[model samples]
Target: MTTAPVRSRWEEQRSFDELGRPLRDVTFCVVDLETTGGSVGDGDRITEIGAVKVRGGEVIGEFQTLVNPDTAIPAFIAVLTGITNGMVADAPPISSALPAFLEFARGSVLVAHNAGFDVGFLRHFAREQDLPWPDFEVVDTVKLARRVVTRDEAPNHKLSSLARVFRSGTTPNHRALADARATVDVLHGLMERLGSLGVHTLEELQTYSSKVAAAQRRKRHLADRLPHAPGVYLFCDDQSRVLYVGTSKDLRKRVRSYFTASETRSRIGEMVRLASSVTGIECATPLEAEVRELRLIAEHKPSYNRRSRFPEKVTFVKLTREPWPRLSLVKRVLDDDADYLGPFSSRSAAESCLAALHETFPIRQCSDKFGRHPSRSACVLAELGRCLSPCDGSVDSSTYAAVVRQLRDALLRHPDDVVELVNAKMAALAEQERFEEAGVHRDRLASFVRAAARTQRLTSLTRCPEVVATRRDDGGRWCVHVIRHGRLAAAGVIPSGVDARSYVEQLRVSAETVVPSIGPIPAATAEESERILRWLELPGIRLVEVDGEWTCPVRGAGRPHPSTATS
Candidate 1:
């Protein structure tokens, strides 16, 4: 019989006090298993098992056997382990092989490079045999290899690298028995290097093994299951509260990526903080996903959703922005009677669009002299012929208003019509061989289309002169609640510098001011469900719908806009 190698008394006396620890007696069994393939779910079989048991950090005994597997060995695996289908054909089944191995490992701690994988594969075989497999507490040398070796030098620390790091001499790798013997040497080196600190109680080692093994399984499972279809996902906290909602064109791709270490930073910090479970619903089409995304954002108010809300109710002049700019009413005359062109969230957006009228286009931007004649004389733009010079009394009211109206039409209602008109004229000119003029029209049309699309519309005004208001202080922000016909929705300014009561008063006053008077020179019709806007020069008292969707109608950062930056 080959006797177990005994360590000298000096090995037992050595202690690594530098690292510090509460060292305890432990048994570590370096084990190996030859398998049909590197998978758990696939019906792969284990062909062999070998283990070297160590106590007091010294090799004590060894166990080795070939498992019958009862299935044809895959050719790749047969070559890899040098255990062909014929070799395993007459081998004893796992039912017979497991008992001897369990007797050898009775009080030892199982260990491997990726120890969990080997143990898991064996546990799977145990389940297949319907045999009560003995529980052998375990440890993983793979995790220790990275800790002991310089990271960059051994980034790919597989079994061989770990064995080489410890100078383990055993060879004939991939076979169960030979590798286990190398693991025994590797364990010895690790114990000497770690001294007392490396020795842990069997229970503590089992706990550590379970944690590492579970983490590895979770990662593998997520990679295997993430889907490719476009959809949305909801992340829930441990208690099942909805922590966040996210949408993806490719659902599986998005969910799987969430597990990567790179994704655990900054904004995704929240995902790491609260993700207890992942649940997903697949959308059949991308468009369906978009609409569903919008609805879910509004409904769940996901902490991660980045978009929301329309611009508030306000007047807009869709002026064409340029080196020499054109300004005019894009949709002025839109009061409660019409859907006003915009509550332009940004001034840059409001001025960059063209007017609606087919002809009589000109720069419509003003120098505070708009709605009034120039006190001194025609402005500089008038001198440049960029303006119609109505401010200087150079243009009559009939002509000036006519020009303003034309500007409004060109900017607001018929942007496409003007584009078509311009294109036709350009084509006509081109046919007549006027390339330069056609080019100008083409460029102008492109500018008009780009500008019009960036705009927002004021759809309605809410007059709740008689309804009630509720107040709430959530964390810090002041949320004003308004109940419209038994349904509750939040309103009011999130105030600063002043109290909530004052903010609520300010909200009431603003809402009343924006909607004063019934039919103040109303427009004929509103387009796209928006009411036509005519001036409410007189406040005759008008019935209005619930409003406040567009502009916050309030000032500063506390004001809410749908597309406002994430908090």
Candidate 2:
């Protein structure tokens, strides 16, 4: 049997379709430096600074300064440049020259024949002298020349060779100012070559000569019409099938990044190449965008989305159904009669919550298949007063069931009892001068409270049968979301300059309906509940309508106003 060839998924696309700022609009600062000796690490110092700032191919500013190297010049260097220790005796120190150079070069792209050498010295001195180093974007003419002019066109990519080839007005004389002027002409010449290739933006010019394939550059038009707003974007293939779904605060910026050279993900590049068009669903707030992203990922199950697709993967803490029920952290919730505390963020959090509960309650610790009559030996925890000793038949089932009820009450009904018990134990420990033990109790109490608060906040959203809310978007528009049974059911935008009252009734009728399960608790996973709760907590969002009771605790674990709530 023959097998089909495996096609590569990584596609290369343009960073953006719309041409960004033109090269003429950008400012370029061509710089050059002369050093006392070789390496700065070997105690070498900068002797002379020269730079020419240009905009639209015209010199806008110039910076030149001679500095005392604070060391004697070598004999060979003095003969080469005709500068000696006596020549620079009246010149200012590099510390004084660097400030003026940096100010002149501010907000401009630094260009040099060999940029690394020049920029490295400046950076090293800036750090040593405790001066603010200008974080300038740099372009190396050497690298750009290598990509633009081949060996046949130019024997070498050196500044002098390029200067002779391009016929730059100045000739190199081993002086900083003359070399910098030559570099400015070279920079403009290279930019002209880049402009012929349709490279306009600074980003495009920087990555223009990259090894990315021509096909990748052609795909730059894919993200052309995407809105620059907070929203979920879908990448659809030629068949109009959704290949990937993503959420971003700025849809255009994020999507455009996939085509740039900086995008390192091979698979994402492949996915983008297969995609023919990109569509964005705008939202009023980031929270709404995130919720929509989660919902779409779950609904579409796109080939590229790997997270939150399996809602069943969420971990839950529940009591086992048996004569001697024990608190257990489980991934799946069964139909068996058992009380649950979460859909926690992780199994470790559920385990931590279980440990906190165990610290206060005398529940069973062993995970044994308990029989009608006890036959197993008692563990060390029973002797230490940790467990009720159900394995040894020391504790009756009825008494254990009553303890289970209290555990359930602490987890679900009211977490205040647990908080009060921990507080009292901590107070007793402190009163007895057992400060170390009291501190341990305090930390465990804090962990328990934090976990409980997160749990209750999420659970409150699930408990609500229906929720309707609205928030203002960046464009002065209102967005409405209708959540049904803890899942995002519908979302619509209300444009600016329109009376909200006129559209609210029609939107409410068109909103999707979800019948809540006729049970004491809402049916939802941790991911779904958290998504809904996060959307509700957005700033300036107002709860317009609610079908069922949805509130945090008044006395215990998940209370919003903990200061006012009594322990």
Q: How many residue pairs clash in each candidate?
A: 37, 5
Q: Residue-wise lDDT of candidate 2 within 482-518, one digit each (tens)?
A: 7777766666666546577666656667766666642
State TM-scores per candidate.
0.33, 0.73
All models: lDDT?
Answer: 0.52, 0.76
Worst 10 residues of 1 by lDDT: 520-529
Writing each residue's lDDT as its tens digit, candidate 1 over 233-296 gives: 7776688765667778666556644542244245565654566677776643333344445556
- Name the lDDT value of residue 194 in candidate 2: 84
TM-score of predicted structure 1: 0.33
Error of 2 at 73 (Å): 4.3
Best by TM-score: 2
Off by over 4 Å in 1: 1-24, 152-155, 196-567
